[model samples]
Target chain A: MNNTLATIDTPAALIERSRMQRNIARMQQRMNELGVRFRPHVKTSKCIAVAKAQRDGGAQGITVSTLKEAEQFFAEGFTDILYAVGMAPHRLQHAMDLRRRGCALGILTDGVESARAIVEFGRANGEVFDVLIEVDTDGHRSGIRPEEDALLEVAHVLHDGGMRLGGVMTHAGSSYELDTPEALRAMAEQERSGCVRAAQRLRDAGLSCPVVSVGSTPTALMAEALEGVTEVRAGVYVFFDLVMRNIGVCTEDDIALSVLTTVIGHQADKGWAIVDSGWMAMSRDRGTQKQKRDFGYGQVCSVDGTVLDGYVLSGANQEHGILSREGAPDTGIAARFPIGTRLRILPNHACATGAQFPEYQALSEDGSLETWGRFHGW
Target chain B: MNNTLATIDTPAALIERSRMQRNIARMQQRMNELGVRFRPHVKTSKCIAVAKAQRDGGAQGITVSTLKEAEQFFAEGFTDILYAVGMAPHRLQHAMDLRRRGCALGILTDGVESARAIVEFGRANGEVFDVLIEVDTDGHRSGIRPEEDALLEVAHVLHDGGMRLGGVMTHAGSSYELDTPEALRAMAEQERSGCVRAAQRLRDAGLSCPVVSVGSTPTALMAEALEGVTEVRAGVYVFFDLVMRNIGVCTEDDIALSVLTTVIGHQADKGWAIVDSGWMAMSRDRGTQKQKRDFGYGQVCSVDGTVLDGYVLSGANQEHGILSREGAPDTGIAARFPIGTRLRILPNHACATGAQFPEYQALSEDGSLETWGRFHGW
Candidate 1:
């Protein structure tokens, strides 16, 4: 029996299969055109089936934000995994265990202190761990600057300590703040060059440097060249959201994920139709708040995915979302979105919103739905 | 093999059991003094163990935001439960199923349409559901105004249709925005009076109105009196957070929930020591952003739960949190909180943070930790 939108419970995460596939094809094709290997970040969906779909669409290996993701993906036959975040020393043992269990997991580090710890842990356990130095291209979050002396110091520490200094990687996450294609292209080049420069520095210092990787959803889509990059990684592109749409990366038609909700009640005088999908379902990610367009919580859409021009989820409680018009009070809200009316809400951040649900109802073009399990927590 | 602060994994939700018990005891005692039955909203923890502790602290029944919570709690021996959110007509069968299984699950409605659907479904299924009319005291979110004629019309529909019209309830959620005792006391009284007035109107119209309920964490604590209110409900009190702290209801010491994270790396020049806990672990709830005191993602604390006054998680990525001083860039951050330095972050909202993890590490006074399971999703 197929679970259509009408049969499923309220507050369910819905993934449009056609849109998701089109997104996958789009990203994979972009990476291929730029002549770089594509490592789709599984942290966005955290579902094996979605990762398999990416692999089917020409993505090689995978990138993860946590070791737990590596473990989950490795268990599902994805051996080549890169834990993208800087390495926490305590997790070294778990990384070693995973590698010992036939997983080609690559760990990351950005500073000398962490690089030393990884070397020490590898030496004491007689494990030659693959390590990548995180280079800061945009200075948005973690990483060492491309020209920083510490980059070579850390590279030497890993290369000389019997650990495999695999390469250098950078993510221009600040690209999300830029709406212009020129700015995005510049950020992409900056990301590519900075990581390549860090790799060159390590090589110039007599250390082996093989790989150079860089990406962010916006940059990956806008980059005209990937000159010195060997691979590109991106998440959230699998499910374009309002934030991405506002950045001019994808259209509303390309957004693959949305929260299916039922209008339970209303405050007609205030033009508010209360929905069951609140912060618990859509998450509290206000990523679009400072963007070119601020989607209060999400963009309102019909159950079949047509955008409702003036409607938005203006306010949300823990279990109740207040749907209202953009300006004037739609005094006939009760009649318009009557009790038990099912609707879909496109989120501000696909990654955060997708994490709120335990499973997603993958809606196929044939009007059938299949349950896809998603892993949560560390 | 017990997990302590030294042994357990980073980015884990830690609950100070002693403080939780104190919070539970304080709220229950106040409700007792107010001469009303205490029904703690289990939506805060969503953990059976935590709910059991609340029950042991004199809470008579549990209030839930979703039917799933009703199902989970009812399975754990909590027979008297209230589904506090406005009921969607499609969920009528699920509510009837729970009631048929001997779970005295009370449902809510605010408008005539929902009331008529509830009555029709109840009549068709031969189930007399304990129904509560949601009255609006403050114009914050959902519910019908206390003096609105729809209240009586909806009450008559349920009462005449053979379904049990149990009572009237309202949540003064706007109380969370007030930082003064005087304002909170006034809001509490307004909530109490408004809900009681709705019940009076129903009785004057010759309808049976037995219960009157009203509460919000701030109002529950600052109420000068809850005279007409027969019962009260509150959720965040069990695990006080920074938002509650800013509301002047709970102090920093009263907060029971914190995320245990490890400093994985640093950008010393920027005075940023990156930790393993980010928005993914702490949640994207910027609840305190507009408050008098904005604790950027969360307040940073020592591993022993001692609050670090000037430090807070200033910025966060998916799995990386930037720990820095509130006003100044502490240049010695690398040496101060070096790699592997374990710290705890007090979230802006406890309910949002706790939902990010599958299980919480309940820390006892003796320094031992016990994993308490929590349910997620609808």
Candidate 2:
């Protein structure tokens, strides 16, 4: 079948090939100019096709959220990998298996308990694993307090064991809370300073701390300089979504992935056009909830992929989405949809929506499509 | 390998052979006593194992959300299936293919556009399709207005095109809005009235309406009688979730599935205990958003699988979930979680969350774990 036919024929994730290549190149150039290594997180586009583009665009290594992702990317021939999630005993065997399969795995840990578990697992299994001490930069999520002595204690615990300590890593998660590039830049400084101080503390205590990793799409993209950081791990940059747009990191045009849906029915009296795509297809991730503009779930686009004026997915049921053009004239476009008109919906969080499907139908700038597989589960 | 070890080791979905058997018997007995046929929706578990149980429970047919699901269930010896989503021109070919594969495929369409598309597709493919006229009850989602003459007009288009008019079906999606059993029964009446009225109109027009399907877990369970309804297509009753609990459909103890996550870290002073499971594993479906009590995502349970006192997932990052017990004493319980303590989290929406992961580790009431695989993608 022709690629265009393939794109429209099946229920698949359509990724514009040209847009993705451009997104990868742009991030790579920006990181290169900043003298930092690009460790593009593979969690966004779990497809191997997209990961190779990142590699070709000068990504030295990649970051993964799960061991399954690490193994999948490793099998596709990208080796230098950092399993960015905190290691657990249940996953230790899987981590060791990945390491044994020739993957240079770098696991993250924040507490003494996790450090002790990793030490015990590594010693018992005779697996010498590399570790990154996670530091809490903005106190938004997981990580050890950067100023606390616990950082040194965890480092000592890992060092005394056979594992290698790969410096400190932190995510400026709260940077997403910023509305301006200046705010993002400030959070970036906080992220870098937090990790740098943690690494320095460990080194001053006579511990080897080499790799200082810090990230978040906003912080990484707007940061003035890395300073002491060696690598940046940003995942969402690969496939920017509406949340990224709301944070001022990228515009709507920069979002490369979207959920392709069909306009199925309407309630013209209610000024509502119902689409076949619902939370099941588009995901219920309301990332824009905290943003200046909460596009309910996402922005609605025309069949030919134009952003519809004043159209938004006003509300969504399990398998149905209600579209409304609140401030615009109801030009009977709802009836015009005619049951089979294809529509593309920009997602709130690419990672969440993208994970719902098993693959992406790689679409060219010319609208031709091909299938590229995605990863799911653990 | 023993089924117990297989469940514990594989991250795929598992069905507690016994729990499923009991769930099937209970539903079947309830439906049989109510004098209604059970055409259980296959979209919930989407597993052959579960479908077989439905068949063994004497389900004459099944409802499916997508053609892909129809194909999977059909291949596994299910012949009677309803393609529950509104039919589009694009999917008509797949629907025809399923008919050719010897499955009795029923297509749902509520508009002239879909009616015309199905007619043309069926005419071109020389395949006769059984079609259900979808009726909009309570204006929750897709279906022609029951009070409008459009339902008859759409039915005429399908009948003129050589398609068999099976009957009418409507989902009481607004039944989810009801808080009490009386409210659910009221919505159930609305669902039944809409479909029965539409079917009567078709019959009055000299058209044979052989079936009437009404469904929604709340509506079906609380429904005093089917009355004019011939079959029901409820799925979530098999694996109740937090949303079901909020809707008063099932108690928390009836929830059979949960994500077994490990506590990985914590911010000691902030009272945030990080777990490995996040939206990636738990899904971004906040189905209980409208409920009186909003569990941010899901309810947190102890390692032994009991609901914890006041513990809930307050906030979540991509790979880490923050567990909090508002105003509860530090209890030193968080410390016990330490890095590798396993905890099970009940999902908000079983269908959406279950779809995120490729499989489920079925844990039995007796504490045995088994792996059960689930279908994914279109």
Candidate 3:
């Protein structure tokens, strides 16, 4: 910001605050129009400022991938939080501790095995935990299918075992692979229908399942209707990335997170200008590798946030990234990006890339920068 | 280590202390037998505890990839450090400051442009920087060719400009692609010959090139003799992962680092048991993707550290890993690795994986554990 890139250290995670705020406003407005409470996943930034901005933009609550996030956000005065990952039994005590501390934390379970553990832990601790049953709408990762008998069984375990069956949620994570609006809309419908179906099953079993939640960045932005869904959640939309660009969800301009790097050296003959933001800074997440158009580590941008059409980080090591043109080699790469010239690299996955940094240098529209701390690890 | 895995949180970075010490001993012993000083790269562990073990075992100094590492390690009393990446002109002031603060810091450069900058900065500051000429041994990443005229040009620029021509260094990073002992040994020789030749060029040009350094984890262990080499540098050997195992550098039993995770849920019909160690825990290195043996994200090991044949992390999301057998679906995955079962995941690239965590749970042979803090970011 304010051309201070020359002064800040190389390989710094930079948040283009203006773009980020715009992205937040867009999502919040969309969710508002859709008539559903928007719970933004804070796992993308893990920064209180970012989540605070979301909340400021009308995010009803926050979603987290780990209990660590729940604790950190809770400590930051965000009481309504969801530890979205399927609950591991060993983490029951930790989750219960947060609940006991009055964090209003919501724990998720996909099976009777973990639901039983949650019930047992609650019974032993004399606490009734608010539980969300994870339903799988897509064959991607975790959760029980909406039609599976385990859905009712897990719901009954939580309800009959004296725990508060709060809701059912599903993430169409496989929506990341889609490039068409039609497919995204269908997937959104499926996610909404499947999660709503699970909620119905619980209610039919005489259990109170109040919340029906479903979303992913693509589906959330493309869904024609929410129908029975009470809330929607999405993470990476906060700082769109190249992978999202490839999926036709967001443009490169929507990307807010970028790694500010300095040209360290060059391999002139190979048409390479080595930058200081390697995998350690940009992260090893090659989320764009198999996409329709692969942005080799990231898409290169001018220091002022304008996209550099051809240049990309074509290769990377522990601490060096080879920035080069995509088609033929830029033979005058050294002249093009001389040593000490600062540039920005838009990451493939904002969540993975942001996790690589301890703090972000948030660049505001007024050309001022703010240091925002982000928590790491569980 | 004692089976205290269950007590520790899932998705934790675990260092097998005994195995790490043994790895330190093995590398130190090889360096001693070769009559070369060993400077273990601190980039892999960044944990002063791990580097301390290497120092006590016979490593003379340490190799670091960034100035942040130099600062952190210097603060920890590791005054002798080599900043191995190509020196960026902007970082010269920081490097000089460290030198002024009594850090025997060594910086590197590959071409005339950066070499000129280093010389000018040193002269203007009246601080003679200890500069290493980075020689390209295998045409991998950075560094000038060992036989190129620019090698001597860089040396003369430092020497004539009133700076210390510290020496020459080369990392045989290409050895990571070799699996056989013969190929590894050959790579070691190539690395040695190229770096020694560069140092010879400097000495022949009447410049003081006191040190000749060479290595990588594979090359450092496989080199038959050091000859004119003064020191060897290697990282990741301290915590060998699947990439090293596939490179035939270290055995499964010798790997000292792993991710401690627990089964959180399962997609029984799909034979997928989801664990807490996802890309966020294990990293997205995929270093072994092109190697002879591709360990998806990581290799599966029992909580006690025994390698589980045919079991691998088939897919991973941000917070979930799909664990399944290789050739066939383990239909009874739920019964085999039920909910709450703790497991250890050996990562693909230890350097990349270890950086994912802020600290490591060091497990001692006596069943005791110590928390070793690791610094992250630049």
Candidate 4:
């Protein structure tokens, strides 16, 4: 028996398969036109089906935030995987194990101390680890600046010891804060230049720096050109969320992931229809709170996925979301959304919301639902 | 080799087993003294070991926020469970299935429409669900007011229509906002009296209101007396967090759950030691934002578990937590906590943080760690 939206359980993560495919194609097409290899970050969906679709749409290799993702995707037959987060020493053994198992697993690092640890671990284990020097183009998180002398120093530590100095990678995650095309385009250019510059510096120092990777959904989409960059990587764009929408990267209709929820009860006088999608379901990611338009929890959609204007999740508890109108209290909230009403809530952050679920209910255009399993935790 | 604090992976949820046991004992003792049965809300930990410990410490039953949790706990020999979320009509079939499976699953309802649906579903399925009317004691979330005419109306709807009107239950969730003992005691008394009044109203109207239940971690700990309350229920108290800390119910030392993370890299000039535990590990719940003292993402503690004054997760990305000093950037952060430095972060909400991980590393007093698994989603 095939399950439609009606038959599937509430508080389940739903990926509108058509929208997801379209989102994948849009990014792939842009990457194709830009003349760069597209490595879709598997960290967003973490489901093989979604990663497979991205690959089908012309993704080169998968980029992952955790080694667990590399292991999972590798088991699913993905050979080339990049462990994008700065590699911690303790995880080196796990990374080495994955590489030994035929996973072309590449890890990242930014400092001299970390580089020494990586070299030391590789030397002790009698293995050469493929390492990417994480560059800080935006100064938002971890990474040495592209022009910093430390970049050459870290590269030397990995190269001087027996290790593959893979290349340079930077994520201009600060692009999330920008809304205008100019700011996004600027961020993209900055990201591309910084990463490419690091690669140039490594080469100037007579070292092997082949790969040059850079991205974030905004930078990936708005970049005018990918001049010296070999590849671009992105994750959240596969399921464009409210955060992306606010950043002007994607529209609400472009959002592929939403939590299918049920209107369980209501507080009529308060004009709140309590739904089953709380922080536990929709997630506590209030990514929209600081955005141009704050969708408290999320924007409420009808059962058929049509936008229900003004109705938003005003407040949320563990398993209960209070869905109310944006302005003037939704006086008829009870009658408007009676008990048993199934509603879809577009999440604030797809990655965060997706993590809350053990499996994704991929609803195709024909209303047939397929359970796509995704793993969580390290 | 057994994994300990030094060896276990970073960004892992660590439950201080002794602290958890103490938390359980404290709540159970309070309920025992108040002359009421204690039903620990398992939604916080969701680990069978934690639930078993609660039961072992004198809990009468378990309260669940999801049917999935009820099913999981039931499979683990926890038969007496209360599905505390409002009764959504779409879930009636699932509820009936659980009841028929010999699990004494108690469901909740707050309105006549839902009550009627329950009775209808009950008659059609010929299964009498042990139903409780949720009362809004503190005007926080779900439930009918004690004095509302709908209280008797819904109770009669269940009784007259042939469903078991087991009792009335209310959660003084607003107690989370009050920090002073006077305010908490007032809220606790209010939570107790209102729930008792609602149960009294149902009994006065010739309905069998066998139970009068009420609780919230703050209220449960501060309540001078339970009065007519038959049972007290609370979840976060099992692993009290900063929210409970600020609410004056528990001190920082009482917090049992902490995210064990490692310094992956550093932004020395910015005074940031980027850790592997980001929003992905801690959860994007900025629950402490509106509190008097906002610990950005969480309060940073040493690996050996001592609070580092003026240190908090100033910022967090997907898998990168920017650990920094509160007032000023510690320029010597790189040397102060060099790369690979292990640290533990006490989260704002234990329930939200715990949900981020698939399993917890329960660290004993002797510093040995054991994995305790927990489930997510509907």
The best-first sequence of candidates by lDDT reads 1, 4, 3, 2
Superior by lDDT: candidate 1 or candidate 4: 1
Model 1, stretches more than 4 Å misplaced? none
State residue B251's C-alpha deviation in candidate 1, in Å. 0.8
The positional error of residue A153 in candidate 2, measured at the CA in angstroms, is 0.9
- For residues A254-358, could you state the per-residue lDDT of candidate 4 as single tens digits? 999999998899899999999998999888988899999999999999988898888898899999999999888978989999998899999999999999999
lDDT (tens digit, per residue) of candidate 1 on B1-378: 878999899899999999999999999989989899999999999999999999999998999999889989999999999999999999999999999999999999998999999999998888898999999999999888988889988988998888998999999999988898899889998999999899899889988889898999999999988887889999999999999999899999999999999999999999999999999999999999999999999999999999999999999889999999977799999999999999999999999999999999999999999999999988
Better model by DockQ: candidate 1 vs candidate 4: 1
Considering just the first chain, candidate 3 attains a TM-score of 0.98
- Per-model fnat list: 0.91, 0.78, 0.88, 0.86
Specify the highest-TM-score model's number: 1
Better of 1 and 2 by TM-score: 1
For residues B1-378, write the lDDT of model 3, one tens digit per residue.
Answer: 433666887788999999999998888888888899889999999988998999999889899999988999999899999999999998999999999999999999888889999989888889989999899899888899988988888888888888888899999888988999999999999999999988888888778878999989999999998899998899989989888999898888898999999999998888899999899998989998999998899889989999999899989888899999998799999999999998999999999989999999999877677899998998
Q: For candidate 4 chain A, which ten residues in a row score worst on lDDT?
A: A1-10
Give each model's clash number: 0, 10, 0, 0
> Each candidate's DockQ score against the native complex?
0.92, 0.66, 0.86, 0.85
Angstrom error of the Cα, residue A52, model 3: value is 0.5
**Whole-model Cα lDDT per candidate?**
0.93, 0.81, 0.91, 0.92
Candidate 3 lDDT (Cα, whole model)?
A: 0.91
lDDT (Cα, 0-100) at B267 in candidate 3: 88
Q: Between 2 and 4, whose DockQ is larger?
A: 4
Could you tell me the lDDT of residue B36 within candidate 4?
A: 91
| Residue lDDT tens for model 2, A206-279 | 98888999998899889999899999999988889889999998888788888788777777667777787778
* Candidate 4 ranges with C-alpha deviation above 4 Å: none
